[model samples]
Target: MSEFTNPGFEARFTLAQAETTPPEVLAKLAIDTHAKIRRAVALNPSTPIKSLLRLGKEFPNEIIENPIFFLLLLEDPESQFVRLSLARSTTTDEAKLIQLFEENDPDIRCAIAQNPNAPLSLLVRFVQESYQRYDDGSGTTEKVNRILRGFVQNPDTVASILEELAYLSDPELTQAVLQHPNVSETAIAIIQAMRGQRGIPSAILDQLVNHQHHYVRYVILAHPDLAPEHLLKLAEDTELYWDLLDRRETLPTLVIDRIAEKTFQILMSPAPALHAAEMIVLWIARHRNTSIALLQAFASNQPDYLYQHWGEQQFQNFRAAVARNSSTPTFVLRKLSRDLKAEVRDTAKTALRSRKLSES
Candidate 1:
């Protein structure tokens, strides 16, 4: 037989690739002199974790791509070695990254933030979580800062995400973003111009709001000391409306009315609105801080056509959310108790009952 058809090589390759091969045999094959056989063992789903680890230094890519490696992660979710390897792997899927993110281990999340394969939505979520953790005093400032820095330094980080981070106004992170190769010159100029200003002057803020780039306007809107009039002005810009609604702790009653009106208009419009817009309306209805007037408005505004198009159950679900709001007025609860939908009526009744018990 020719050297190319060597039986020993073929036999080793078969054993390395076979799922039914014993772990000990795979472990032995992991060190095979032939690179192909060793690669096959690394790629084999049935390869023992110990053998995979042994082969990891030599064949890191093959080991990371192996299904068994992810299984090992599932088996030991806290294993730093496994989590870091998967987090740093460019081949790691978005779904897996998201799952790893849910673990809320800061280091793992930081790794994912910096990973090129991480989805944009997940990166946005990481930024939001980092901000929340920092605000709530739940996370150490050092760790939160590190996570933010990781997102800033990631090559895949987009302008929108950079905009959100810029809103934080962290000097160090701003510097990192300025230096990032992926960041545009315009963005760098904007950041440079805004840098070291203790509080943005009204004139400067006005100029920023009208600047061609939405990112410049976003930075102005996110300013810690942004004036109420400026906020109201920015709210008129539909592009920034959702961000304003999501980021602000308190909004003027007029702004809230505008949001409510827009929501109803979209639902009634001939064309479908983005699902995200509808979710914002839902969030407004369910938030405890939502104006009592708006909750009552949502509870009482039962348009027949809305029920017809949105489905009676779906329409009732929105009313039910309003009923669940702690700030919902008792009169509104009484009104909802008579709602045609049982869910709406039941939720309103429960809230009313809970109130009476609390008073007693």
Candidate 2:
């Protein structure tokens, strides 16, 4: 004000405005913009995820009903916040959805089945409810495909829903569920679930071995529960097993070495590819010690390896066995502590420190 050129005046003015914002006023203003809501809720998730869900629920019906909006936030940079936010929105009963399920109109049933943010419990409940009403005339198959749309969009969560369903199901439904077309992400979840339920038909495992989707086939191949026949089949699916090299991060440790070997083979084939060489190094870094040993024998001539894989964030929401007890003494803890990727290293260290402090 003195010279109309005070360098820090704008900064001071902004701070004063922020300070003057009443708690209620600021909360209201924070709710006005989705991006601002994201920032506010991220700063204060301890408050509740529903703070932003209120914003989503305020939208016009058309906007609320748009699958693309859900899809957008599914991959949104602020998606984790939005997901937590919407996760608390009210849940409707299968009763509300049942009539829609019976409607001859596929779109209505599609809508009934495909609400992107529906809870897993709701999905499983509706599947059962819809099946009860179906009786060969209820059009359950069409609804299954509609539900599958949700499964494909967010496979990780839907997989858990499917797993929970698998546990609570009779053999017929469980059998059909495993063979569902979107078996990509659900295979591992279902297998992990069957540990207690013991109802997953062996046929599902066999079908998983030859499943069309790459993810389904790879997960089943990596299963410790796999019988010798499954292993023998994978060993013979030479071309298919080699294809797993394309996505080694999702592959479990059991087959990671095989995938590494295949990548090396593809790299050295008569026509060499640079991507293959680079990816082999990245795969080696992920599975680390054991795969590193295999890589040395597989790619002795490969140049100095500097892998730039960043997956720690996507992995945060999924429950890993290593995360169950929150202990840090395990081998994974040591490997992750030294992970070259900054995100992986930081999250691992944070998790270990939190676990130590909690145990203390």
The residue-level lDDT of candidate 1 at 222 comes to 62
Off by over 4 Å in 2: 1-203, 218-224, 227-257, 270-277, 285-360
The predictions' CA RMSDs to the true structure, in order, are 15.0, 22.2
TM-score to native of every candidate shown = 0.43, 0.26
Error in Å for residue 90 of model 1:
42
lDDT of 1 at 124: 79
Which residue pairs come into collision in candidate 1? none
Model 1 lDDT tens row, 1-360: 142233498888998898987777887888889999999998998887777766764676787788876787689866876876677677778888889988988778777776777788878777766546544546436766876887676786778687656545577888888777677654564465455344445665665666544555655666665676767677666667678777776676667667666666766788856456656767778777677877766676555555556665565777999989887888989999999988898999999999999999
Best by TM-score: 1
Please list the C-alpha lDDT of all candidates, in the order they appear.
0.72, 0.44
RMSD score of candidate 1 (Å): 15.0
